[model samples]
Target chain A: MGPVELGDQQMVAIQTRNLSRTFDEVVAVDDLDLEVHTGEVYGFLGPNGAGKSTTINMLLGFVPPSDGSGTVLGHDIATESLALRRRTGVLPEDFGVYDRLTARKHVEFAIETKAADDDPEVLLERVGLADAIDRKAGGFSKGMAQRLALAMALAGDPDLLLLDEPSTGLDPNGAREMRSIIRQEVDRGATVFFSSHILGQVEAICDRVGVLREGRLVAEDTIEGLRSEFDSAARLIVTIDEPTDDIVTAVRSTAGVVDVRIEEADIVVSLERDDRKAPVINAIEDAGGTITDITSADPSLEDLFAALTTDGDGTDLGVSSRNRSPGRPRATEGDA
Target chain B: MTWLHVAKKDFHDAGRSRLLWVLTALLVLLVAGVAAIPYVLAAATNDPTPTFESGLTFLFSPIGFLIPIIGLAVGYRSIVGERESGSIRFLLGLPNSREDVLLGKVVGRTGVVTVPIVIGFAVGGVVIAALYQGFDGLDYLGLLLFTVVMGLVYVAIAVGISASVSTRGKALGLVITVYAVVDWFWTFIPMSLYWILERSFPGFEDLPAWYLLLERLSPGQALSAISLTLIDTFGAGDVDLTAAGRVAGDVPFYLETWFAWVIVLGWIVVPLAVGYLRFRSALLN
Candidate 1:
């Protein structure tokens, strides 16, 4: 191939075509064509054993692809891995720290490995571990350890960042802080590709998401594009002052309403379009229903993920059922 | 090379470990304590003229046993521990190739073995000089250098096994088997072959060049072969200690004492190359 142009490199940060990998008889990642644009937060979403880590491992050359090819930051993923890693940072999944080394030392090792002139203190501070910079990593909590790994990943101000399950062990507040740091990196004009099993975590930050199911790319789209395409039906919960059997019947008869039910004192209206929200509200009011509260309940990425991943038999789509980060609200999932 | 960074980091991390301190203390005691044994023995038997050569001869077996243990102890956990602890992700997550991590472990762990060895010999050298007559400083330094080279060989072997295996138990098992075979039971190979070839147990004298070569092939024997020449004999018993004296006729070049340096060099290079090849293609998934 001729020398790649600068515009082509700037146009795409990561691109993989027909990538496949299998361990013995079990396919880990299959014929996957994945693309992440420069300066975008692309969320690689999947449950446990969905081959998310395997894909990243192949991209980083930790594991070779059984078939096909890929590139990261205009470098071939297989041949130019070290050069790619030099310019791109990675926070790997289930990564452990050197217990003997202090937080600063870990970042220093990364800086030294990259031959970068970054001050270890500044990197550690960026990850919000400045207070524990001098402390041994053995004493750091799980959240603190994750932050330290992030600091090391940030050592060289890399052009692209591959973060695999970056919020795995963090508390709600710790996760928010990490997300903000990610935003800052994005602001620095770095492309960020992060993976997560939990969709709520990426719902706020991801510009686009790709869902992996049984080693296949089931869906890849912008967040809004995903919601509108996969889920034309949205649950609109309308709470009234009194019991609402009449309102439920009235909303069920509305033009775009799919299903309507009186769930306690609230009329749970499933509509075919978001515009149906206004018509359902009008229908309820015409039926003498006094509306006290209205919740649109557009399918959270969680619901969209479930709809795309599960089959009619629900014969194990391989998505994790447990919603982690207990403090995040799951009330939206009740009628979803 | 990136391996240099990995080595520096490995050494820096190992310096903070309790294992290094413990190794240093043990080597100090073994070196100094073994040196004084020859003097104590001569005084008890009323032949109280232990030279530095005699003192080192007394020191050889213990050094042989202790150095390999120190080497294995430092090297066995180098890579496998990172795999088990999941810290290998951090190591390889950076720009380091697998060769870098493997080579770094070898050099870093060799440094770990070197620290206590240099300290132990320094402390033991003073004790040996004061306790024994005819203390040859240059010869003592030769023995010290040979022991450090031996440390590198054992560390290479241990690091090789550490890199090849997936778990700590497998690495430890391979290391123990290797040490036991090379250090203790290597005679079985030559002895069994001799029995098959000549139909009798061979004596020390008039042994075929191949037979002696087989015996010299083990890492422990090959290392001691180099060390034996580095020290002066002092003509105590006028014993024929050279390899030429044991062969049935004129010695072959392979049986020469200098050839053991080649063997020792092979021990250092072969295991590391094998481990690097295996680790290079290893899927860190």
Candidate 2:
């Protein structure tokens, strides 16, 4: 199917319009606009120090915006922040839990404070923390602590969940488990807004993704759309019976084939589009070659993300750009 | 309701800490040692000079120093520790109002610290009664009540400092410095000023009005006044009507000293209110 079209009927769980936070002369979040619909997992993609956390902090009302305003769960982000806090849960990038309190007590205290009726043991079990429920959090491993943090965020059965780099310390299986829990939460109609440096996880779980660079959002679209937009180059891998110079020359001479590289018994050809597959096959046949096998490769999310967040000159979005006008948001529509 | 939950959690958590138990034990020992000193002194000295009032005076002097120390220790890390631990974000992110959290913490910590002070005073009062065989019940009650109030005022001041400072170390240092200045130096300054004013100015027989103001500035001085009142009420033995005439007149006049109570209550309320306001405005992310 094509990119899932978000409809207006989907309530906006979070919406920030021209939100900005500045510390003295440094702008941490500059004219950032974001929207996350109900039951959607919006992945905020950025590297360290990319202002993703700052934007999340603004949404959580931990920091007030220096410029514009936003709303969380239909509550004003500024004036009615307490009401917003009631319906929202946050797992910060850094894990900080009480060292002396048991996991059960910690979750219990959080639930009690929020006036939530959920059983702490049940919540802990949901996060795979039931075994360590009675143990103090000081001895918890990083993954375990992350899970506990997630459990704390879920204490009140909040409608909106904000996770910052939730998969940072997880092993492969733990990461998979986290994805499943995220999916479960989404299935239960909870909107998840998470930030991550990894592209594969975002591609796997995020329904919509926004890329932030140097305090501004440089790109925002569905994962498929982002990949398709920057997908100008494709790969054609063909396993041939024999390595011959004529076959290589024929394949390289095709109209759309840009580069060729040989690995063992296979010839890898770079093409502009999948339609170029036919001409390359025809050219190989004309060179008296038989195609053993063929596979088409497209750009991954990592590649598209890298291209969109970096300038033509290869300067990363986190760096100052000479081409970028002062106070102007970076244009992302026609980049690829 | 959230405040009640927060208070219960804080109280339970604080109760579990070994440091709190150690501090309480130390306070009890200190009070015990001070209370026994009078009896020990009276027994050892054959001069027959140290009476019950002398013992009362001796005990009152050191209890004054201990009160402010307990106040500072109990309150210096109240909010700053939470900020450092990062659990504060979890609490502040809840629907509960910051004011409720602040006030609840104040109540919780005060309860934890004041328990030992009350027990110490009660033990001291019992010791005074048993050792001297002439102790005043009303005097002991008043002294115990005054010590608790002194503790409340100092705790409020320390909490205010804690809320204003970002680090526990800074809060501890500031509370200690302020306590030392107000409890020790402020008392001496007013008395010295009173002596100088009396010697230098003619018709200055009436203590300078500033003297009373400055004296009241010290929590120790307030404790001293309360202790003296307690001793007067309990230790006096004569009951002659004419002799009690001046005493009766002064008793009624002293009872109308509403300004003293106002100052003491202000000491508790003003700093606490300021701390709550500052804490509510704090950025805990």
Top-scoring candidate (TM-score)? 1
Chain B TM-scores, listed for every candidate in order, come to 0.95, 0.79
Report the lDDT tens digits of candidate 2 across residue range A298-335.
Answer: 54455556544555332222122222332244333233
What DockQ does every candidate get? 0.72, 0.43
Off by over 4 Å in 2: A1-7, A232-298, A310-336, B45-58, B118-142, B188-205, B222-256
TM-score of each: 0.86, 0.78
Q: Which prediction has the highest lDDT against the true structure? A: 1
Q: Can you tell me the DockQ of model 2?
A: 0.43
lDDT of 1 at B104: 92
- Model 1 earns a TM-score of 0.86
- RMSD over all Cα atoms, model 2: 9.1
lDDT of 2 by residue, B104-210 (tens): 77787777777787777667666666676466666667767767777777877887787877788888888878877877678678667756766653222344445
Residue pairs of candidate 1 with colliding backbone atoms: none
**Candidate 1 lDDT, tens digit per residue, A1-336?**
211344555467788899999999899899999888889999998777788999999999989999999988888989988888888888999888899999988998999999999999988888889899999999888899999999989988999999999997899998999899999999999999998877888889999899887788988989898767535656677789885667678878889987776657777776677777888889989999888987766545565576455542222211122223312333322221
Candidate 2, pairs of clashing residues: none
The local distance difference test score of each candidate is 0.84, 0.73
